[model samples]
Target chain A: MTLEIQNASARAGGREIVHNLDLALAAGEIVAVVGPNGAGKSTLLKLACGLMPLHGGEIRFDGSKIGSLSAGELSRRRALLPQECPMRARFTALELVLMGTAISGQGRPMAERVAIAQDTLDRVGLSSFMERDIMTLSGGERQRVHLARVLAQLEAAARNGAPGCLLLDEPLSAQDMARQRLILQIAKMHAAHGGSVLLVLHDLNWAAACADRIVVMHQGRIQSHGLPRDILTSELLHDVFGIPDGCIHQHCSTGRPFVVPHDLVMPEDINKRETPCILQ
Target chain B: MRAMRVHAGWILLSLLPLLILVMLVAVEVGASGAGIGTLLHAPDVATRNLAWMVIAHIRAPRVVLAAMAGAALGAAGATMQGLFRNPLADPGLIGVSSGAALAASCVIVLGVDMAQSGFLNGWAVPLAGMLGSFLVTLLLYVFATRAGITSVTTVLLAGVAFGAFSGALTGILIFRANDTALRDLTFWTLGSFSGANWERIGLLSPFLVLAGVIATRLAVPLNAMLLGEADAALMGYPVERTKRLAMLGVAASVGPVVAFVGAIGFVGVVVPHLVRLVTGPDHRLVLPGSALLGAILLTAADTIARLVAAPAELPVGIITAALGTPVFVWLLSRIHGADIPS
Candidate 1:
């Protein structure tokens, strides 16, 4: 396994936020943690990234206890993109991305760091925003800049021969449809390159489509953990998310699961329709 | 949109000539009216002695001391703002100046006679001031930080409260002091470069250079911290160590200056901001730019303070606050109303 969390629990503000969670991610695998808001999805990602200390369990990376490694060691091993991009400084997108390499000790010349930053920005569809002040960018654009920063960190680590893990919290919440797909594709590509990914996503269909394994969390506990094709049944969705039956459908063309909230329609309106128009 | 490519090195290089020009001008236009040329080419030994006294003993030290103090405060301000991740955070916001002033007042009021002591006479006041500032900073940080994250708002509020608390104590010290000590205390509190001499400058250099160099080195970590403490740690930047180092650097930079020159206002709060306007938000650029610009500004401000009232001389703090307020207000207005979190 590339990353392992054995019975990890964490508390925030005098309350336990993550409780007795055991999960592991192997190399070249994408694991998505899906849950409602405040269900400890973000907390789990943060704990795994070592941003928060675990109260009652051991976190290991490459079979060594996480707490034993120095901060630089841990940082060179994993990159996290937090939920809120709270960067309000007047840094250009390129400058912001270059800051990611700070943990790697700035041994590379400025030109090389700039080249790496620019390359990641290009991958995130922000090649044109290299010089633009981050403050001037829209929320979505700023999120992409942070995404590019994480990607740059991972790439730098990979070049050093450590295929690090990427822990992202809602990495695509602000993007449009095309960019969302692009972000997932980027995550998949990272995993395919011998890296590991633990993504916190809210959209169930996106999880089902992108994640090799889905871990559903509720009230700070994992409710289900398995392949999406087997675990993401109608009963689990209804129990975990309050989705009624006939709402989730396996796409005929793609053969992947998708959610259609057909239960929201009024009974009289549904009866008036000869056939449902959503699938058509 | 294309990124704006600002050559920070070239900008720093360009600032050198301007700073030197200001320093030279400041050295010339003192109340003594002894120009550098006349001082250099005195005809008689007696005249040369007098000229040297004015140039070396009076003018040069004042200018150099002002430069050192201003540069220290400005760099400290920039580092503090970056460390706290708040644009409005200043070195004085954490009560360093007030604490130093309080200690110095205690020494003066209590008749410590630092200048007349056996071995520590020359160094007593500055040492006490440095200790005072360091203690307050340590206490404030202890009370304000929790679980590695420092809430910027808490630090600011604590600074204000502690400043007022120390100011009140200083006021009590002043009330009990005799006429001689009172005059000295009043002048010191108003903040002037009046007693500048090579001795005080020598006393300040080690701390100034140490803090300045450390803060400049911290530019990258400070930028990492701009993303927030947690993110900075996750990025491999040593968050706790950076915080401790930046805090120590601020105290070391500001403490000795407050001990020697009293509380020179606004240079700490204003120069870094003006530097950022030119150098962008990169602390690497901002720190060095703040240092040079700060020295230049204080030198110029001291010159103006000496000449504007001519021989009577206004306090340098009065001049900095008078000039800094308007600029600070203009900066505030430039930000959109929505930018101020409602």
Candidate 2:
């Protein structure tokens, strides 16, 4: 396993947000975590990235206990893109991306690291936006700039013979349709190159389209984990998400399950109906 | 503007000479009418001695102290803004100046005997100011941070409270002061460079050196921190250490300057903003650039303070506030919704 968390529990704000969770990602695999709000999906991502301390159990990266690794060591092994970056400084996109290589690409020639930053920006379709101030860019464009930053970090780590894992939280939330596919392709490319990807996604259809396996979370616990086809069922939707049946369908070309989400079920209606599952 | 980003290194290079030029002008122009030429080539030995006395003993130390104090406040302001993640954060606004002022006031009122003694004369007030600022910064940090996350709003709001609290204490001290102490107190509150001397320079250098070193080391970490604390840590920086060092640097640097110069305002806030307008927000450029620009601005302002009212000078603080307030108001109006969190 490239990354593993065994019976890990994490606390935030004096409460256990993630309780007794065990998850692992093998090398070259893409796993998607889907859950309702406050289900601890983001907390799990933070735990996996070592940003949040685990209250119990252990996490290991490449068979080494995560606690044993220094911050520099851990960074070379993995990179994280948060749900929203509260950046208001007037750094140019290129300058922001170069910050990724600042630590990971230590001792590398400055020109080469700048080249990597440039290439990553180009990959995110932001080649021309590099000189632009990050604050001036649209929300989606700024998100892509940060995506390029983490990608640059991983690329720099790859030069040192470490295939870095990418932990992303709702990376597609700010992206448009085309850029959403672009980010998925980028994740797939990272996985194809012997790295692992663990992403928290809210759009079940996009998660099904990109993730090799899907994990559903409910109230800080893993409800189920399996292939997309097996996990993205109407029963799971109706039980966990309070969505009615018949909203999920298979895509014709890819055979992946896509959620239409057309039938709006109000909270009052959900309360009036017979409760299918107990929500904690 | 894009060209400025690419050539930020060049801008830093250019600021050095610009600072030297401003320093030279500051050293040349004064109400005493003593120029460098007079010191170098006077008509007689007695005239040259008089010029030497005015320039060497009076103007040089004052100008040097102004520059050093400006550099400290400028760099500390930039570091505070970056650490707090708020562009509007200033040493004056965040209670560092007022905290130091309060300590200095205590030394003036309660420790008058110690201030009169030869051994603890110069060391007492500055040391007390340093301790005061350090305590306030630590308290603010502890109060604003929970679960390793700092709230910018709490930092700013608490700073206002601290400033008010210290101001009231200083006022109480002012009420109990004697005639000699009252003059010193007024100077401390309004800020002046009239007390600048070689001894004060010797006393202030170590603190400035400590601050300069911390500012340079914090550049990259502060850059990463602009993305927020968690993201900075994931990118391999020790975010907690960065925050600690920044606070310590600000306290150490700003405390001595406020004690020595009497709480000069706006140099800390205005200098960094001016530098950012020219070079963008990269702290690598911002820190050193603020230092240089701050030195230039304070030196120039002191010169104007000396000249505008002739022999009787206005306090440098008044001049900085006059120049800085309009720019600050304009900045507030121009700020985008995205720049500050609601």
DockQ of each: 0.57, 0.48
Q: Judging by DockQ against the true structure, name the best candidate.
A: 1
**Candidate 1 residue spans exceeding 4 A from truth:** A160-162, A267-280, B1-8, B112-124, B142-155, B336-342
lDDT (Cα, tens digit) per residue for candidate 2, span B259-292: 7888888888777877787677778888998888
Give lDDT for model 2: 0.85
Interface RMSD, per-candidate values to 1 decimal: 3.8, 3.1
Q: What would the per-residue lDDT of candidate 1 be over residues B78-156, giving only the tens digit for each residue?
A: 8888876666778887778888988888888885675457787756666778889989988888888897766656877
* Residue B71 in model 2: lDDT: 89
Q: Across residues A1-280, which tens digit of lDDT does each residue of candidate 2 receive?
A: 2999999997778888778898889999999999999899998988888888889989999898999998888888889999988787878899889998888778889999999999999999999998888878999999999999998988887873646889999999998999999999999998988899999999998999999999999999999999999999999999999998888888877999988775676877877887574321
Worst 10-residue lDDT window, candidate 1 chain A: A154-163
TM-score of each: 0.94, 0.91
